[model samples]
Target chain A: MQIVVDLNRCQGYAQCAFLAPQVFELHGEEALMFTPAVPDDQRERVHRAAAACPVQAIVVGERAGPGVR
Target chain B: MQPDTLFQRITDYANRADPYPLYAELRENGVTRQDDGSYLVGTYHEIAALLHDPRISSDYRSRTHPDEAMIRRNERPPSFIGLDDPEHDRLRRIAMRPFGPPHSPGRIDELHGDITRIAEELIDAFRGADRIDIVDEFAYPLPVTVICRLLGVPHEDVPRIRAWTNAIIDSFDFTPGADQEKRQQAGLDARDAMARYLGELAGGRRGHPSEDMLSALVNDAGPEGRLTDVELMATATLLLIAGHETTVNLITNGVLTLLRHPDAHKRLRDEPGLMPRAVEELLRYEPPVHMLPQRTPLADIEVAGVTVPKGAPLILMLASGNRDPLRFDDPDRFDPEREDNQHFGFGSGIHNCFGAPLARLETQIALGALLPYLDDFHLLDDPPPYRRSPLLRGPRHLLIARG
Candidate 1:
């Protein structure tokens, strides 16, 4: 699955960091530095991180799972 | 008549054990327009939509104060959780730095061990007592202590903090015929007192730096970094109340619900790994903050074919949303393993419970420790008396057997 974060909309709330720190890294000034895609092994952690996003900014896609539609 | 204006039934003390029946009745009508012109979104889908909608404001004052009528005549500003964008964004960011990431990453998650120790200590105390009140003994102290330690609140001052927080939160009860003026004034006084106390703490930190949240706010980098005195008080007041009351309910409710449903507790005891999932279910089935009432519509918005007029008062029932059948299978039933369960135990969206990680860790270790130690236990009384608040629901006292 893949993840996407629109930095423009991101206020650096760091809620994403609270969820999945490994995937979402916040630097000084709360700027988000992150991994856009997760390998099959890290899918679980990625999904958790996505759920944790308060803004729902992190969008995740399935590699070969249920369709978004 | 549908009793449209009669919110009294919603507050019926008889419905305390299971207010779901009344909530279900409200949903049958799709929406209940109150006498005060506010709309209570009891339906599952509607609350979910409102919570997700950016236009819905979490600021309670915005919803309740039409003319910005203070919940109290003498009150400072509220925490960012009760605020809107730009300003809410700014305060919440600065506040988040010391406790959470970009500045202090993994602070909450790292407290797992300390929380576990705290839980064990509480459990150790319960070893000799055959019957105990979970609220007073375990649930109450654990969260309050953690918040105190994390925020650098003095242990001596915790009782005062608790009293102030309780006074403010007490005013949030939606009980019909409550003295509006008295409630508002008390809520205000409590908040004001909390701010003053926290401010003093912050001032002390200025001369002497320490390893605490108050000190961090005092010793910020630049103009943008520091919080004004008012801002610090408001923010600290938020943490204090949010710290003291919320998790106590979570812990108490978890134990009560589990004891109520022995099958679940037995399963959890058999498999400790399920503690986390069980906590999630507890959040859904019986959340700490049941229905957060401060969501005001930013503009006219259509939710489930019902148009919520712009600037109209909106009540986002988080509890109702969690039980929406559309969201979960047999939503009423508490199933820890129920996957795809994105419940709003904590406030969802931007203002989701900031202390969720702390709350979760505390409950997990708490329930975990109690599950085993409570070899054979049962509720002291069925339908235990509950606190007088619908927004924050939990038993007034949950006496359970140990031996």
Candidate 2:
């Protein structure tokens, strides 16, 4: 699975970091550092983080998860 | 049909405990223009969309003044929350530096130990009481102490701060025809006094730095940062008030909601891991903030098919959006495991609640620590007395007896 956060739109709410700390890390207040892709194990939380974003700044799919249509 | 009257009723102090039904009605009617010429939006998606829309303005400068003199007298340099970008974005960035990701990434996370300790201490203080006021005893003190410490304010100053907080909150009453002159004056006085004190405190940190957020604001520097004395005063007051005031309601409301619903309470007690999701549900089901009416439309805005003209107030009934059935299944039900709960308990978008992470942590810890005592507790006053402010809604005093 692939994950992306539009750094421009990201206001550093840290909802992503809270929900999926393994996949995303927030540096200071302005910088959001994250893994672009994650193994299937972290898929659920990453998706949850994407949906939880107040700005919808997170994008989660260049590659679909296994068995996901 | 009178759409604006519904807003009046919702803001009415009488309906504070259960304004959800009124909000449902607003959603049903679609976007409503109040008799005051402002607009009220209660639908979930619409509220969410408007919150993110850059066209909408949180700047108070945009509002059509009821009294030009009063607005001028009452207005101070707005904290970033009330400003539009790039100004809002700039101040928020500086404020966020010490509080959140990147530079101080682990700041709030590190407060876990301190906050948990505060919650535990507050709970332990409840050991010998037969009956207790949750607001005065448990919910209020925990956040007050945490915020005081966070801002480098002396804990002994809480009484003074509380007085100011009360006055400020009273000035913010949204009920129609509420007395304004005295309360607004008091609020301005309190704000001035608070700003002066915080300014002095921040000044001290300039040469001799401390570990608190105020210290960071004064001493810390970056390419995009540094707040002037006026900005610092406004920002400090905003943080101090914003940090504790809403959080007190959250903890108080969480306890009240849980005690009302024992099955859910028991579930939370049994599975402590569910605290995060449960806290989110508490926020959705019974949010601290029922309405934020300050956002004015910058231009003619169409919401749910109604046109809200420029310069009119746009009341975003955030609490209403939380219960909108379009947003959540079984919207009114307080399910601890409610998924995809992107609640407006904390306002959404750039203006989303900055203290959300801390607030969530406090509520989680607060509910976790208090759950044991609540296990053997019963409500002494059902539908407890609520505070007068409609913006921040919670029981004024939740009396509970351990039997």
Tell me the tens digit of each residue's lDDT in model 1 across B106-163: 7776676788888888878877888899998899989898898989988898789878
Question: After superposition on all CA atoms, what RMSD does each candidate show versus the true structure?
Answer: 4.4, 4.0
Q: TM-scores, in order shown? A: 0.86, 0.90
The residue-by-residue lDDT of candidate 2 on B65-84, one tens digit each, is 53343375437887887789
User: Candidate 1 at B124: error in angstroms?
Assistant: 1.4
TM-score of 2: 0.90
Q: Which of the CAPRI classes, incorrect, acceptable, medium or high, describes model 1? A: acceptable
lDDT at position B116, candidate 2: 84
In model 2 chain B, the worst 10-residue window by lDDT is: B65-74
Which residue runs of candidate 1 sit more than 4 Å off their true CA positions?
A1-16, A19-24, A27-69, B1-6, B60-75, B178-180
> DockQ of each model against the real complex?
0.29, 0.22
Error of 1 at B25 (Å): 1.6
TM, chain A, every candidate:
0.72, 0.84
**In terms of DockQ, which candidate is strongest?**
1
